[model samples]
Target: MPHYKKTKIPLLWLRRHTSDREFMLISSVLVGLTAGMAAVILKTLVHYIHVLLAYGNRLLDQPYWLVVFPIIGILLTVFVVRVAFNGSIGRGTAGVLFSISQKSSMVERHKMYSHVVTSAFTAGFGGSAGLESPIVVTGSAIGSNYGRDYHLNYRDRTLLLAAGAAAGIAAVFNAPIAGVLFAIEVLLTDISISAFIPLIISAVVGALCSKLILQEEILFNIGQREFFAASHLPFYVLLGVLCGMMSVYYTRMALRVEELFEEYQSKVYSRAIVGGILLGLLIMLFPPLFGEGYDSIRLLEGNNAQEMLQNSWLAFFGTNEWLVLCFVGALALVKVFAATITIASGGNGGNFAPSMFVGASTGFFFSRLVNLLSFNNLPVSSFAMVGMAGILSGVMHAPLTAVFLIAEITGGYTLMIPLMIVAATSYAMVKYFEPYSLDTKKLAQKGQLLTHNKDRTILRIMKIQHLIETEFQPVSPEATLGELVEVIAHSRRNLFPVVTADRKLDGIILLENVREIMFKTEKYDLVKVRELMVKPPAIVQYDDSMADVMKKFDESGAWNLPVLRNETYQGFVSKSSIFTKYRKLLIKTTNVA
Candidate 1:
């Protein structure tokens, strides 16, 4: 529900008149308008940057400047990050996922505009990355910060954040359904019926913003002039498989190269310089590897498919048909390198466009190869479009988003069957090899990712260190029963850990075992902690997962267990404490962002 007291004067009147659902619905429209405008503005900014370079600027009039511009973009972005943003700006979708997990559904205010500015400079100057991720980041931050200012809870705030993301994507692609699905599939762990209204409203509003504000040329729309052939199902299956393989390669290569650049974390300038130079070299060799590559993807559907070769080093040779095919294939393979360097070197961008670019190239190359080598003629444009779905499905692990997005952007669902087939095929194949998508992999490794599994997700967010109970008094094994009783008088906890002189966990003493002896003052001086204490049913390792902790709790059937670090007793972890923390976190994390 919208909080009137916490909010400003303008929204307080609406908050008083309407219920929670109505307020959210109304807010969804506002969020859509705002995020949609943001998306439109970002697109306009990139377009103007491109125009400034192409028409007005003679500095880049020379063809070779194409190679140099990406490097400059990287350096400029790095400088901006170091100076304007305090030398730290998280890049891509991973940062958003991290914010969702670690932050209580509250994105920093800077993210609302930071991503737009950085991505504009990065992509505007021909960095081989996509603006979609930045759009998502910016839009989500807007929603999150809005929710925070209005004092919304984590659930409603997260929903709004996703609405903003959906709005941004819908605006960019003019595909409302795709935007909603992308938010659902990629961002949220679970959803309720109430969530859909805001998502749908936001997406429609975003799409409207795109329709009203942006021209047809700046959009990512592709004209699908061909029909899907069931007879070509076998070819699509092969293409799906190819896209799946390429997706794995793309993910692995990107992660691997980013690791290489990670070594130069402290040396941002030298790294950017080297990475920029290499990126420029790659862009020089393959002009299509520059920027979002949407133009080149669009070009692949036409007779001038080879025309992308005009500004490239390959232009020295004639545009042979086979050479064009190979060139497209090379673009598919090497574009990841260009994108990885662009981002790893400190420029802001994402793999969304690169995946689509690769998929399109893969599809074009496959269809062209088939037509050249075999008797049957394949529809190159259809293959190119479906191939985009394939890569998006595999890379993002969002088959529905890829399917509907391609369908919506291309004007209709004429290729729905092929879209589904390729999307499903690629997703299945990639899943068998890599369980996590490119964005969530790092979080998964750190046990910070939220999944569809409610119990698992809750446990992943629960840290053992946070649940440890140190209030329980520790008794030395050599301590007499009277001394133990003295210590026990102060501690509220019934369970006690027995420690040696070296502070190693010798054993544990349950209150039930000591109840009989504690009252018998005659035996208090005679009994030692070593003799009274016995081995606990189980000991919890310091680094154990919360799931493992729960497992030990169940297996031992004990309410408390000793937590140990290198065999030394740190503290006791009680089932009650864990359950308390669990219930608290469960409320915050369930069906969250």
Candidate 2:
């Protein structure tokens, strides 16, 4: 990215003059406004691009434009990312989480606009991905940079980062409550009640922006349909189970496809071309796979599956209800592949929209199939809407967010009971198989994720590599006791590592073990350092996770352990050092009093 000289913030004086609580509340408004505008711009950009492509003479004349548009979109996105951002940018929501966990919530300023530009290009031209994630990233960067510029602490910075995301989510869908829940559920799970105010203010402001500025056609809305019937409770629960299963499929399939693309990350262009082509083929077969698929969601919710099928190229084979059911079922299964391909191929977008799309299709297929085979009359629209929540809950592991977001979008809580049942069931099912959400699974594996488990969170944040102490001094294993005595006199530490000439650790020498021999200086030369030293109870590898190091410490019952890598000496990792860092991080990471 392009570099710019840092400038002073005018709000610094206001922050210094006002109490933190007051300043934060005021800052929330500003963050919400900015983040909401970012959402508006991104959505507007995608909207216009879509309009131009749909109506433009050249694109309209091309019979297979669906195949070519997505490729072109990926090409443009790849070009921008490679040429403008130097071949890399942030990794959407997971990157945001990493910044909070490891980077002290200090998101880069470039991400404020880069994701907006890139995602618009990716989703605008029919790339099968969601724009919500990029929107969240952009909004989060806005809040983070604002906090950093105004000299806020880590706690405040993280809160604002989440607040900004809440605003973006609120602004895009015009669902203020869901926006707040998204931030709380997805970004800051263990936040205090006091922290909710800023998030609430941001989401409200964001919803206002969408209400006044965004056109109805651009919003993700389908006002409530018929009220929920008690008779449909069983079907909703079954849909929940289906959503849970589909969610598992979505997470696993996306993970595998992304892993396959990891090999081509360095070859951006090659991956983009191949991924773009595959995504195009899928979108051609199933037209609903294009962009965010919100239109198809509306179609499904409106009981217009016939219209939805008629728009797809697959309809050429047949339009029987069973065929339609199969086609819709296929959409649910293939959406993950399309979305992952869109992103892995250099397109910038998120899984949020795709999850909703898949959930809608699954819900529609399930309800439709049952209706065709039996006398039971199921509400297809309600099932479609609730399905969005189920998949969202399962895929993102945010049940509350899923329930409220759909409820808000529909402008009523009439389906709240069913939404809860499906969301809870789906979430419970997915949780049984995967402990971490799809966005955080890899980070958790790499020991970089901060979770609700306070112990793990603190440990994960503390890097043992930085805690190793090298000043304990080293002694040559061949050195005599007299040499060791002189070395010990200058060293403050009670323990010393015995090393060979080539800097390999043989064992450790404790001062207490050699105290008797050192006093008898007359025969000091006869006592070699090798004979004085003994094997340490345990050794810590240089790259061991904090959890592993702690386990070693507990088992060894030692205050310090020798750190080694490839049999070579590094340094000692003391329990004191780890405890010290853990205490400090615990303070730094806690967001409430």
Cα shift from native, residue 128, model 2 (Å): 1.1
Query: What C-alpha lDDT values do all the predictions have?
Result: 0.87, 0.90
Write one digit per residue (lDDT tens) for candidate 2, span 257-339: 99999998888888989998899888777877878899999989998877767657666876788887888888899999999
**CA lDDT, candidate 1, residue 491:** 84
- After superposition of all CA atoms, the RMSD between model 2 and the true structure is 2.5
Model 1: pairs clashing at backbone N, Cα or C within 3 Å: none
* C-alpha TM-score for every candidate: 0.95, 0.95
- For candidate 1, the lDDT comes to 0.87
Encode model 1's per-residue lDDT on 375-426: one tens digit a residue. 4699999999999999999999999999999999899879999999999999
